[model samples]
Target chain A: MPAPRPDGACRDEELLAAVILRLIAGLRHVAVGAQSPIPATAALLARHLGKGQPFVSLLSSARHNFFTDGGRELFDCAGQGRVDAFFLSGGQIDGAANINLVAIGDYAAPQVRFPGSFGSAYLYYVVPRVILFRLEHSRRTLVNKVDFISAPGTSPPGVYRPGGPVALVTNRCVFAFDRQRGRFRLESLHPGHTLEEVLDHTGFDFDRPERVPQTPSPSPEHLDLMRGVVAPLLAEVYPQFAATVFGFTRQEQS
Target chain B: MSAIFRSLDEALAGIGDGAMLVVPPEYGGVAMEATRALIRRGLRDLHLVTLPASSLQADLLIGAGAVATIETSAVSLGEFGPAPRFAAAVTSGKIRIKDATCPAIHAALQAAEKGVPFMPLRGLVGSDLVARRPDWRVIDNPFAARDPIVLLPAIRPDVALFHAPMADRNGNVWIGRRRELATMAHAAAKTVVTVERIHDGDLLATEASAAGVLPALYVEAVAAAPRGAWPLPLAGEYPRDEAHCAEYARLAATEEGFRRYLDRYVYARAAA
Candidate 1:
């Protein structure tokens, strides 16, 4: 019998990273903003796989980021079509692709107010591909409609929107957004999650195939690269995340 | 153009009630010491703008009742969790919120820097924030056939306040590669800066330093406040006091606890 994959094996975060890495393929530039550990990991991994073809920019790092002008430069780059892909998360995301990063409940008196929108509204419109990621996949997060639209999923015709939501990745499943149809189509279900559970937990309606497929797990080689290679790169900006996700500790090089 | 001041209090002078103030994010050189000084001054009704987003500074000011209205994209405690005071005040209708997206704030400030009435942006076409924001308008792109774009009014603040790694005798602050500080200074009527220390010579004299210098032309005042960006980071300089931040997150979870936090950290330290 084949031996199990070594001491540092895959976890949910690693799986999510692999999924995001696949989604970001063929992009020239993938930029990750503050506090997004998974996307940052995926971007770094993609760079490693692409042999530095697609440049990765982690907004939190001083060394990795080439933008001399600070956070504003990131917006400028996105507006100029220099950024290819970006990641956005929300307190609540509706089926129509609307994301609520503002508050939940009422606008006047919210029960919960998330960290204000972090350039998602602008990046959603400018970046060619914007991937919506939320680790928690439940009715509360995946809602029928967001309380306050921090960034709408779709825009009116003839608007100068070169970008919008492309796909949403959650713990339970993956959904590809149809910009023309203004709805999501279920692509695949993650392992250990069922269609019924996804339907039960999801608050929004989406199209789906009669026979859904399971999200493929990362191969042993991919897992090795992620833990050994990408994890160290991630430590530059997100040390805590790298430590927590892959048991990666910064090592002193000779 | 000797903008040097002896104290944070003196540097922050001239900023009175109802003045519009702009600041940077936690990592991008936030003036935490200056912010505390402002809080201690018992300032009121200030219009505070976070360049795009804020963390502790906004919440601290809002909690202290120093802010009347805030115009920014978002505020949170980051990894520590949601900002308690900001959430409470917003939910209780204590402060007026001008919810913005990240780039919108940058674009508006850019407009102010260029002395323009407004700047047209590509996004916010169908956002509810667009519908709610009476100030932001959607107009046909003048150059395009039928393309609609969002136009944000200029955000010309009365003062732009921040902390930096160093400043020189000529009042030129070396902000390094964090150029948003320069943008803020250009957009505001006056700019107040607090630095870790004074550089021995003119920052603009050296080519390496000149690239990162916010010239004295835009600076109104400067003060030396070492570790000015404490509890937060100064980009390439120091890491945040993470343990303190975590403790702050733990204590600032409730109104009473936040009050105690103010008494212990902000008020008590100032008195000491």
Candidate 2:
């Protein structure tokens, strides 16, 4: 077991953001939806790293969003192959990358109902790279098969799908999606977690290398940029997350 | 010509039981005061079409038993977590839910706006939403063989209701960059709105504001209701009352607690 880090070191969120930044490195545009602070952080960091090459659009932020035409423009942009990357989370995600954002049990009488599918049903097909992110890495969330397919991982041969899952980032590990095989391959385990821990908690089967590398932590420069620049920018849209993680309060921004 | 109503209730008078009411998303101006007035009026069996998605406004309407069916992509309080009343309603089968994706809702409304019978959307071919929604159809595209797409029917609502930062006496509502409000107004048969204040001059008079104005041509009525989008934020005006939203989420978790909330906020307002 890895020992807990001392104070002032890189947090788990910072590590995850670093991992996500690598996945979306060369993308032209990365758009983030509501309630995804970590992905938002990564997108912002990616923009900073790219020297303003990749435009980051936070749907909830007035400062970050460039859409003058309103919410529909996001979808329009995705359909036109303009949006390069996006993120989606699920109540239950399966091995094949199927995500269930609707209900847990029967469609008529559900045992547990999550928020209905947002843009996942559409953007998952249009956005070139859809990053599946779930902070909780547990059996209940990552199931063998989703109860409902809010958006499918892979479409049939004839389906018009320019986009699908490219990678899934969880707290425990990172898994890269293979479009041909329609499955996930464990890429790396996060710091302080083991392959056994990932296997123990995961509900679905996935391919893994014999010797998995540990996910690299954010560098000093990455930390400096995130903590100093991105944290304040993030405060405008996700005040709670900024306050909790970076101690950048909304009051400070105002 | 758009009629300027004396009160929010009067502005919403044309919307009766079973009316199809289209509303803006949470970030777009939400007509929460009008929603409370609707609850107070005891309107029932409404078919709510929340443009793409919603938060407090949809949940409150569902909790108040004002909505019989909801056609929306999702309804969750952004940070506060899942909408308790909406979750309970879905679990208990109290209201009919027509589950849709965000862009599907937008496309459907855009179809109505363009006077088109149906609109073709790119995704949702393999989604279970395709299976559930019998109204949605998958067909081989005529333009290209072996390519499949989904078509969504136009959603023409009976009334479009929302709150805005301001509206001129001529009834042009200043929505700024929130153009979805204009889309809703254009698609709906009638459009009613509550404004924070009435502008002294024409909203379309200035070239700068004209681009953001929803012309009085589409507006049926406008009423003055200060702080109309309470608990929900209106852009450039007031920020969201996070504490009140958290309180609502906590209180509305249980049936008894939800009733207490209604008595305090919804029903109590009748006297005020």
Candidate 3:
């Protein structure tokens, strides 16, 4: 395996993965869905750091999954509270945490159609620590109000919702969800990013502290674990991401 | 107790136009070969239901103008990218979409399997999916006061179709751990299957094998089509043809390109 960066600087994806690791710490089970390499990396990293305390289930990898009952088992397990953490992304996310994965315009006549909601509606309500991850931080993606609500961030009092958004992780910063207020509070800005930059890109209003801390860089131990231990495992499911981020290819591992 | 093993055409004859057909996800034994045949036969007004989500199969059918309605949680090509045909069709208002969540589809099928009217599921209270789907009712939980839940109507499809690794003369299919196929077969009025090969021995002959077998009781017909799930992986048998899928994604991006794809892959290949 290639060594960690000589400059001790972590790549953007590595930093995102490290952030996910911190968010999902101490969870019993973390399930990474299809098309999420950074979250998958974080789940695997957490497994290594925690000495395999939390079982990692990658939906795309036959090797990483433990379910024998097929695709429905994941949703079934999440329904029963077996899954502790899961990831969700959207074409548009609002201050209230409503995610739009369906379409951009009217339901009857859409301007842009996204992939239909894939278990997000239920998983967001059942999985206690549902982490919202969107790599792009822009006005278009972070909207004031979504065109459609694939899944809402908060529910009414009578709604049997045990799971909801705990935090929204973006490329610029992390915004922790205030479930009570139905709003996002800016938690921290990532390295080389500013509060003004985040505000400029954001379309929705969010609360921020007077003194915001910079999102910490991954420690040397975390970087080594991500590169040496997690990268190879991730290559099994996300070969393209592994190749791009860690410079590790499946052929080399084989 | 023997199954009516027929040619692929004969096996799929019962699935006429305007039929509500239920299918599996991309990973769960997709019948790519059969999908191509359906397009070749030029069946129309198909109310296609995906057991949660789908990818290439759904996209191809939509691009072929075979599907009039699609009931699915999502249709995406994973790493290859968004399903071009599906996106285009939906944006153009070319087909009716019954947007669903993964669990909603599963629970609805399970409800049908048990011959129930509907199944009460947690979540989806605030989602527009419930609002758009008038068939999905949100009722106060009978067991608990002030608790609301969504109840999905049982989806009893006209036919269920998929590819499997193997089937025996008795029509018992060994699905391994993909038990959702069993649920689909149970919920649908008739089930059609295509297998890579027919097993000489009875799938139910051994307890180990019988555990994963979908009995012929639900199956209407079976046909043998080796590598039936081409382009898509069939679990233990083969990995997905990523190169082919990427090529498909590139070619299926436009109407003209999609027609070219049809000419090369679907129309050119003779149905066995």
Candidate 4:
């Protein structure tokens, strides 16, 4: 059997780094919202891939508030009708493809508004394909229907919405929603996650893969790039990110 | 051409002397003149009350000494150019940077949009941003029953400039992706649009949905100049000029190098 990947063999940062590599391998562009994980990962991926993605390049700029700028190629928002794929993370998303970045309850005083819809509001309208990637999926975070459609899923799919939240990549499995109904269905499972694990987190009944396949593990070449190219620069460009995501130092191992 | 501007001077006429222009955010600087035409303008003494700047626009604002201070949302404009010098300046009291976030800036611009004195906000609890900005007053949630809220005084700029994919003669702006920035600008004062082309309603006729991408209500003037995003790219327009961009990257590596490049390009060529 192939040697099992060990935490000691790879840093904690590799989890996110590898995920980023996996997401960015074939995709050309990915829009990142404020404090959203997809953009964070795409930023690292761009650094790994190279520079010059338009809006992706100038993330701090309001113009790049939505859309992907992988290297020099900037993808337009779905509303303006320009996007191939994008990712959404760091917030609770529900079955209807609606999301909540504001307070769990009321817009005013609430459990937590986390951070008002980064770009989910408009991104929901504009970006054609938005992939929701959750690091932590729990019953508390994942719901049958999101409290708010921070960004609408298919926006009345109306026979030709043609664009909406496409995939939801989580720690356990990959899922997709019906174009018209915005219902959830399991697409694929990660290496470590199981059907029960997936069931435990989702609030709705989902169509799972009959013979689910293992989540594609990061290749060694991808890992080497993750550790060497991504990790090193991440340390220089975003040291805090490196410290937080890849916290598997000797202290963590111990 | 947008037909809005009959002259090149009009095309490059957003910033005139001391204009309190907000650099919004650098999400591809969609608001910037294509190919970053603002870089070619070389304005000085621009009042930029903005976010924690993190990209080249932040660097350019600093380089031109135009940034008065920032009531910012973030300083993370992607990893490019030098680490923002404004943060250290604020910490050292050399510059005045009122820390805020996107919501704060949005409220400020909203206040501008409404021509109001101030707007109340929710966040800014126990944040270093609030502590850093001595002028910012945090008080009881006047809107709410009990909880406290953050009050950001209205900040209406004299003019606002943004880049768009296309615009019409009457100042109807249409953006490519999301219009978040456009909304932000709409909430600000005297909106100016810089677009790649002024579609004459030929192909745009069929694109009826895209006709009024940006309504005439907010935009005061429209400049339809191709490649307006310059270093940035418009959806169907030309991408960034890599050669000029490479030269910029090389020159902007150091303060001296940046200064020399700026001097050669901005200072020397007063007519640029």
Candidate 5:
């Protein structure tokens, strides 16, 4: 791949759709949270694809209710990890890639109260592969250490571990475990973002890749499904969230 | 040959102001259409006491002043909009809050249906929640003379309004799943069933999983109302009908908007 983009070529929403479209499939139950873009889009896309295929394929079809009625059952059931893959996010994620959705301060009383760990703890235990998606890129967003470990990473890294966050899919690029150190290692940069830009936003340091790859360009098909289908669906639940997660036009910003 | 309603007003004629009612989720797959109408009526202080938080209907009632208290297990879902409002209402002391597990709530209804004193449940020992709930009695099994166990008294709701995909005049109902809503109907003093379509009258004769709905003796009304479960769904009916539920979620998101909603849609549009 050519030099990695300085600031991620694709919009975050496009990456979100592509990640979900690729990762989530063939599960009977798909659970998400109140303000989830990936799970919400996945459930809708799953249903649009076929309710019978995803949930029924898992043999959990009998218990699953795919994306009908605003995907209530799916959102409610995210922690059980009966879902094929999960989409998760947090206020601050550390160098180790541990998630923090509960709070930003001390345990007893938090300085800032985000929706205290919707199902991060449980989803960490159950879901097979979790795509941790973050929209904002700022020092505050990427922390040296998470204020709270809302969800734990694998007990042992670079090994076949079932529980814990599987990958970190963010606005910039994908980050994976540095098998030896168990710290987040920069694997690829978005098409447009550079290493300097990534470091500027990161709160902690990660070992650099000799050459970061471009996050694959979403196919026109993927973009259509994402912008046309997924974005509208997310907008319904979270009204304020207009424009794409990463595809914010100047119009949306203004 | 006729539509399911005698006119929304006549169908609603019986549900007077401050009518006490009870509803349950079939474990889940709670219906929403008919209940939405009842919700509209209740949006203005109907003295409704929800047995637990099964139906999305709880939020609508809580806003209308129909529901003064909320009783149930820890919310199964991490994020439910009405939950925040209902929780706020309870904590703010605007509504009373009570604790009951999924099993306890079901058992109570089962007891009411079986005409028993109380039903035994699997868990809830030494939980701090035990201290808060008054309706639950921790007493020795006088009959068995055994160690003390928690006894949740049967819930005999004054009226039960339920929606099914289809119901016959005789009151036989069929739904997509085997849920707990049936138990609530069995225990209630009266059951009013609204169905999406009444069918060719032989509809009640079909042997579906939920076929043994409240018998005619127990059912007082059978109005036909489709999309009963708006924000929620009735299994095998139609896919969740998201656009419809989204509209409701939008309307119910705020306290003031939800109340005004109750007034305009629930009260004004109410057939009665």
Candidate 6:
């Protein structure tokens, strides 16, 4: 086997995608929503890796999407338990894994209103594995408690919930959410990020081991597939992301 | 009887101020031309419901003060960025926002289409969306043992409006595979359509075309409005005007810039 290359060779986006691919491991069907290039890349990579033969569906892409009923079909499939894994992000995320995608202040007159909840409230309850991802790991983003609960991380005891948050991946570290305990345990810190930095920047508290492991970088082969094969596929939908991250030429994209 | 109308303005005449209007997505078939006409006519206080989500159509309307309340899953510019006018309005509490998830909106509209009082759905039981919405109720499943589910009230709109690539002389609009528009027409009290062109023959005469045709029964008024979904795509017919959208997003970021955009695009288009 070839010697492991320096982590600097890999881009931050590629690393995040690799991290997400690990979290979504063993899932059969993974659906990604609009404006989520990192999750889209990870889903595509999972298909490329040929591990579980997970079927990837990117909603924004015309080629990858198989739904005929417009936007409603995705929700309908999620409702019937057809979708196995999905991704979500929020303007604010708390220790309990609750997300806030709506307004920041008063509901009537908000100081900051993120786009109203799309399908997060519904999909969060149905997709067996909902991976919460936020690239920015800061005090403002990872709050002690969200201003509004777009989707609560945990359901009541009697509620028939098949899905909830399984893991949270951010630029600083990875957090594993315990549904029963309703708390997050720090899983691993990303390379080049210090534990102290995460602690200072994070607004919410979480459990962590004495010794935290560094997040593993993507294998050279995985990087190759991501840049060469998956990048082109993603370019079909997220052209701008593909161009910026993988340096895909305009001629090649078209 | 045929449902054809002589003018676009006349076709949209039934959709007055404060009417609840249901429409499809930006790409599928959004009546952008009609939205501009409404702006031109100075229509106000309308309740706009995007079937699941919207793009520039909702933002443009809200920016123009044509909408008083918006009920939908989301309103985003897509690729361009967060919809500026929409974010501005929401932050300032200019218009009421009934925040909904995609499935809830679809389920409620489905109930309306089926003439049902309400529809039970899974997955909303633990969500804050359930607690916030008075129209949505959590009820125990009647048949299932010790089961709880969310029941959303039917969303019956006053007018279902959209643009299509073509409509036959019989007023059956060709929507291809985008069936949500048909559902919107079925759910709303009145349905008005604008098409790029009118096909000469009957759309439902052939097996292949029948699947694509939204039958004339649901469509009350049809007008020939070429390039109706400009600056936005109409599925297989035309592509989105990305440059125009970017310009709009850039200009609409600020209050002063948004007014300039209104002057240049919305008002100028109306004048033209």
Best by TM-score: 2
Give per-residue CA lDDT, model 4, range B141-259, as digits (tens).
Answer: 54456455557787777676667676666666676444544545665667677766676653334466453365666666776555555554444454434345456666765567777
Instruction: Give iRMSD, candidate 3.
Output: 2.0
lDDT (10s digit) by residue, model 1, range A47-114: 88888869888887876787877778888899899999999999999999899999998877888777
lDDT of 4 by residue, A1-254 (tens): 11345643543234444555454545445555444433454455564566644224324333233423221123223434555555665356777766664435543233433433343433444456667777677887777766544455654312224446777776667777776555777866766678888888787566765787765665676565554554444343233344455431211100
Where does model 4 sit among the CAPRI classes?
incorrect
For model 3 the TM-score comes to 0.96
Select the stronger candidate by DockQ from 2 and 3. 2
Clashes of each: 1, 0, 0, 45, 28, 0
B-chain TM-score for every candidate: 0.97, 0.97, 0.98, 0.76, 0.79, 0.96
Q: What is the C-alpha lDDT profile of model 2 across B53-92, one tens digit per residue?
A: 9999999999989899999999999888899999999999
Model 6 regions more than 4 Å off: A1-8, A249-254, B1-5, B270-272
Q: For residues B153-235, write the lDDT of model 6, one tens digit per residue.
A: 99999999999989888888898878888888889999999999989899999999998889988887998888888878777
Ranking by lDDT: 3, 2, 1, 6, 5, 4
Model 3 Cα lDDT, one tens digit per residue, A1-254: 66546776888888888888899988999998878899998999888778877999998787889898878899889989999999999999999999999999999899999989999999999999999999999999999999999999999887878899999999999999999999999999999999999999999999999999999889988888888888888877777678788888776321
TM-score of each: 0.95, 0.97, 0.96, 0.52, 0.55, 0.93
Each candidate's DockQ: 0.61, 0.74, 0.68, 0.04, 0.05, 0.58
TM-score of candidate 3 chain A against the true chain A: 0.96
Residue B66 in candidate 4 has what lDDT?
54
Candidate 4: deviation at residue A175, Å? 28
Tens digit per residue, CA lDDT, model 5, A118-160: 4454445446666677878779988888876655554442222
lDDT measured at residue B142 in model 1 versus the true structure, 0 to 100: 80
Least lDDT summed over 10 consecutive residues: which range in candidate 2 chain A? Answer: A1-10
Those runs of model 4 whose alpha carbons end farther than 4 Å from true positions after fitting are A1-13, A17-254, B1-3, B6-8, B11-14, B28-42, B51-54, B75-77, B84-95, B142-145, B202-212, B235-250, B263-272
Considering TM-score, which of the candidate structures 3 and 6 is the better prediction for this target?
3
